[model samples]
Target chain A: EAGVTQSPRYAVLQEGQAVSFWCDPISGHDTLYWYQQPRDQGPQLLVYFRDEAVIDNSQLPSDRFSAVRPKGTNSTLKIQSAKQGDTATYLCASSFLGTKDTQYFGPGTRLLVL
Target chain B: QQQVRQSPQSLTVWEGETAILNCSYENSAFDYFPWYQQFPGEGPALLISILSVSDKKEDGRFTIFFNKREKKLSLHIADSQPGDSATYFCAAMTNSAGNKLTFGIGTRVLVRP
Candidate 1:
């Protein structure tokens, strides 16, 4: 089976610009997650959804970051106004709801904000 | 506050030697622990995991030894190979936390051939 896939493997933007990252999860997976991984740091959970319903988004920066999984199979993470601090890799992961402990990740979109 | 902590930001080992990575967490409620391996440009992939019920878990050359009482754990990579050179992250999650993972800073391992 194909693994999770992400679009626009890389992105470069100036401060205050907007960018969006898209993700297509593995087939038959019902749980999707978005994580932010800064250089030299571990992946931190930003948001997650289960079958079109958001399970948790407390870690997400509501002022500038937003994510949605409308149909539950695909997800999009958007940053309305990028800042230098937002320069990091955005990763999307998925897992079966029954086996949520084992998550598979995508290549991730590397964003650079100047 | 960083709930999860990893010791020795980096390590170097010979191909035939073993590489050990340590991890500790402050949350006593965390019941699931997973270790992830990541390459330079790729996202992390699950390597191994252990539940609070088990004190040890082994897969192939990788082993996880957990100490629930001390909230500490270690990942042992036996007979390390050059291909095993990558950043390893230790993560934890509670059974009631909706699968939210708390990850450590990660240890970058370099296996010399």
Candidate 2:
């Protein structure tokens, strides 16, 4: 089976500009997650969905960042206004269930904000 | 404060040697510990994991030794290869509260011939 898929493998934008990342999780996986990984840092959870409902988004910057999984399949994470610190690899992942020991990740979208 | 911490921001080892990576967490509530591996231009993949109830778990050349009381855990890579060189991450999860996985700053491993 194909693993999770993401779009725009790399993106470079000026500060204050906007960018949106798209993710398609593995087939039949009920959970989807979004994470941001700065260079040399671990991936941090941004938001996630259990089916089409948001489960947790506390770590997400509510002011400028937003994510949604409306169809219980595809998801989109958007940064309304980018900043230099926003530069990171945006990752998408999925799992079969909440208690699953493993999560499959996408190739990730590398964002370089200047 | 960072919830999870990992040591040796980067590591280098000879091929066929065992590489040990360390991780510790402050929150006692974290019961699930996992390690992730990522290569350049690729997403992180689940490498191995151990639960609070177990002291160790092994798969192939990888093994995870966990200590609940010390709030520490480690990953051991046996018979390492150049292909094993990648960024490794340690994470903890308690989904009921946040469905989030707190992660340590990754450790980049470089295996030499």
Candidate 3:
């Protein structure tokens, strides 16, 4: 089976610019998650969804970040007016169930905000 | 606060030697632990996992030794090979807490032939 897939494998933007990362989860998975991984660090959860409903998004920067899974099969994470601090790899993962199940991750979209 | 912590941010060992990565968690409720391995420029992949009820779990050359009372665990890679080099992250999660994982900074392992 195909693993989680993400678009724009790499993105470079100037400070204050906007970018959106897209994800297509596993075909039969019900849980999807977005994580940010800075250099030399572990992946940090930003938001997650079960089907088309968001389960947790406390880590997301409310003012500049937003995510949606309107159709329950795909997801989009958008960062508006990005800053240099937002430079990191954005990973998309999917699980058969929720976080209790094994999570398979996509290669990730590497973002560099200058 | 950091819920999970790992030791030896980086390590190197001969191909035939064994490499041990240590991790500890602060949340007593964390009942599931999983180790993920990531190569440069790639996403992490699940290496192995264990539940709280068990103190040990082994898969091929990888073994997890857990200590519930100590809230710690160690991942042991035996007969290491050069291709085994990667960053290993230790993560903990509790069924009660939405099963969201809390991960350690990660340990970078380099197996030299």
Candidate 4:
């Protein structure tokens, strides 16, 4: 089976610009997650969705970050008015439901904000 | 606060030798632990995992030794190969958090041939 896939392997933008990252989870996976991975740090959860419903987004910067999975298969994470701190790799992962489910990750979109 | 922590940000070992990576977590509710491996330009791939109920889990040359009381775990790669060089991340998840993972900074391993 195909693993999760992400678009725009890299992005460079200036401050206050907007950019959107897309993700296509593996087929049949029900849970999709968006994570921000800063340099030299582990991935941090930004938001997640089960099917088309969001499970949690408490960590997402609401003022600038937004994500949606309309069809429950593909997801898009967008950043508005990006800042220097937003310069990090945006990773997308998917998994099934259950306590023992293992997540598979995508290649990730590396963003560099000036 | 960082819930998961890993030691020895970087390590170097000779090929055919055993490389051990250590990790610890502060949360008691985390029952699932997984180790992920990533190359320089690739996303992380699950290497091995163990549930809190088990003290040890083995898969080929990789083994995970878990200590529930101390909330610590170690990943041992036996007969290490040069291709095994990569960044290894230790992660923890709890059922209450919708199985969201909290990961460590990661340990970079270099297996010299």
Candidate 5:
């Protein structure tokens, strides 16, 4: 089985620009997650969805960051106005609902805002 | 506030030696703990995990020793190899919290050949 896949392996933008990252989860996986990992730091959960319904998004910055899993298989994370502080790696992961603890991650999209 | 904490930001060990990574969390409600291994430019992959109900879990050469009372845990890599050189992150989650993971800063291990 193929693992989770992400698009645009890298992205570079200036402050106030907008960028979007896409993700395709593993087949038959119902739970999808988005995380932000800064350099030298661990990944921090930004949002998550289960079968098209958002389970948690409190960590997400509502003013600039948003994510959606419309069909439950694919997801998109968008930053309305990127900032220098937003320079980090955006990672997507998925797992079966029954085994939520074991999440598989993608290669991630490295974003740099100048 | 950082919910999870990892000690010794970096470590170096010989190929035949063991590498020990420590982690601790402040949340008492966290019931699940998972350790993730990440290479430079790649996302983290699940290495091993343990539930609060268990005190220890071992997989191959990796072992997780948990102390629920003290809210501390450690990952032991036996007979480390050069291929094991990577950043290891310790994450914690709660059953009631929608399985959202809170990760530590991570410990970068360098295994010398």
Candidate 6:
């Protein structure tokens, strides 16, 4: 079976620029999540959605970060006015509904803000 | 304050030895615990997980030991090999809180030949 997929394996941008990451979850999966992992640190939840509706995003920096899952299958995470601190690997994962079972992950998008 | 804490920022083990990674969480509401393994430049992959009802879960060379009262857990890798060298993260979640995983800082392990 195909696992989750992500686009733009890497992106480098200058401070104050904008960058976006795209994620396509596994087939039939209803839940998608976005996580940010800094060097040598664990991944932190940026946002998550269930069937096109945001389940939680309290951890996301609303002023700079925005995520959307329009049709409940694919998701996009955008960072505006990126700062050096925003440099990290953006990971996408998905799991089936009702069953918070194991999440299938994709090859994350590595971002570097100069 | 960080909700999840992982011990031993890094560790090194000889090949065929055992590697232990520890983790603890402050959120009592967390009912699901899982361990994730990540290789260089790759996303975290599900390693193994245990629900609140069970105390131990074993999958091949990996095992999870959980203590509900202590809100602590550990991952034990037996016969550690060079391929097992990576960063491991302990995470927790709850049905009521959604699927957002609260992860530990991560433990980097290196297995030598």
Q: Please name the candidate that would achieve the greatest DockQ relative to the true structure.
A: 4
lDDT of 6: 0.92
lDDT of 1 by residue, A1-114 (tens): 999999899999999999999999999999999999999999999999998999999999999999999998999999999999999999999998763459999999999999
Go through the candidates in order and give each one's C-alpha lDDT. Answer: 0.95, 0.91, 0.94, 0.95, 0.95, 0.92
What is the lDDT for B85 in model 2? 94
Steric clash pairs (candidate 1): none
True contacts kept of 4: 0.77
Write candidate 6's Cα lDDT for A1-114 as tens digits.
Answer: 898999999999999999989999999998899999888898988888989999889989999999999999899999988999999999999999765678888999999999
Q: List chain B TM-scores, each candidate.
A: 0.99, 0.96, 0.98, 0.99, 0.99, 0.98
Estimate, for each residue in A1-114, the C-alpha lDDT of model 2 and write its tens digit: 898999989999999999999999999998999999898888888888999999888889999999999999999999999999999999999987756447889999999999
The 10 consecutive residues of candidate 4 chain B with the worst lDDT sum are B94-103
lDDT of 5 by residue, B22-93 (tens): 999999999999999999989999999999999999999999999999999999999999999999999998
- Give the per-residue Cα lDDT of candidate 3 at A114: 89
TM-score of chain B taken alone, candidate 4: 0.99
- Local accuracy of candidate 3 as per-residue lDDT tens digits, B2-109: 899999999999999999999999999999999999998888999999999999999999999999999999999999999999999999999887859888999999
lDDT for B111 in candidate 1 is: 99
The 10-residue segment with the lowest total lDDT in model 5 chain B: B93-102
DockQ metric for all predictions:
0.78, 0.73, 0.79, 0.83, 0.78, 0.77
Query: Which residue pairs come into collision in candidate 5?
Result: none
Judged by DockQ cut-offs, the docking class of candidate 3 is medium
Report the Cα lDDT for candidate 4: 0.95
lDDT of 4 by residue, B19-93 (tens): 999999999999999999999878899999999999999999999999999999999999999999999999999
Q: Residue-wise lDDT of candidate 6 within B35-94, one digit each (tens)?
A: 999999788999999998899999999999999999999999999999999999999998
Superposition error at A105 for model 2 (Å): 0.7
Reference contacts reproduced by model 6: 0.79
TM-score-superior candidate, 1 or 2: 1
Better lDDT candidate (2, 3)? 3
Classified by CAPRI criteria, candidate 2 counts as: medium
